[model samples]
Target: MPPLRPELQAAHDEMDETGQDYAFAVCPTWQGDAWEVNTKEVNIYSALSGTFKSHAEATAAGTAWLLGV
Candidate 1:
C-alpha cells in the first residue's frame, strides 16, 4: 500500500481519539461531485473514494466506515 499522507493519518487519529466514525462525502452545499468531510453515515453514497475505514468497531464512531472490508 502507498504511504498514508499526514492529513489522512490525522483524520484517522481524530476518529480514533473521538470514538467517532469519520467519512468522506460530497459537499452538500458545494456545486460539484468532489467529496468533503462528513459525520453522518446513514446514507453516504457520496463518498466517491475512501482514505481509511473500519467496521463494527464501535457505536460512537460517527459512521461504521465500512470500506467494504
Candidate 2:
C-alpha cells in the first residue's frame, strides 16, 4: 500500500530472512485514506506513531515495529 517506507520494507524483509514471527495491527486514521498503528482506542506507545498512506503500509510498518526490526 503506497509502497511501504524503505526502512519498514527492509525490516520486513529481514524478518522474513530471519524466520521471525511478526504480525501487524492496522486501524484507520481519523482521516480517510490513511492508517496508523497507534490510535485513540489502542494505546500503542512507541516510535511507530506514523500516519501511513494506506492500510497495507500501516500494517507492514507496524509489523516491523512490533518485531523491533
Clash pairs of candidate 1? Answer: 20-62, 21-61, 21-62
Give the per-residue lDDT digits (tens) of candidate 2, residues 1-69.
398665445444544554434434455554556766641113222335668887778877876666664
- Model 1, residue 21: distance off in Å is 5.3
Q: Report how far off residue 23 is in candidate 1 (Å).
A: 7.1
lDDT of each: 0.36, 0.54
lDDT of 1: 0.36
Could you tell me every candidate's TM-score relative to the true structure? 0.32, 0.46
lDDT of 1 by residue, 3-59 (tens): 645544554454455543435322322333323343434332223333223222222
RMSD in Å for model 1: 10.9
Model 2, which residues run further than 4 Å from truth?
Answer: 1-24, 39-47
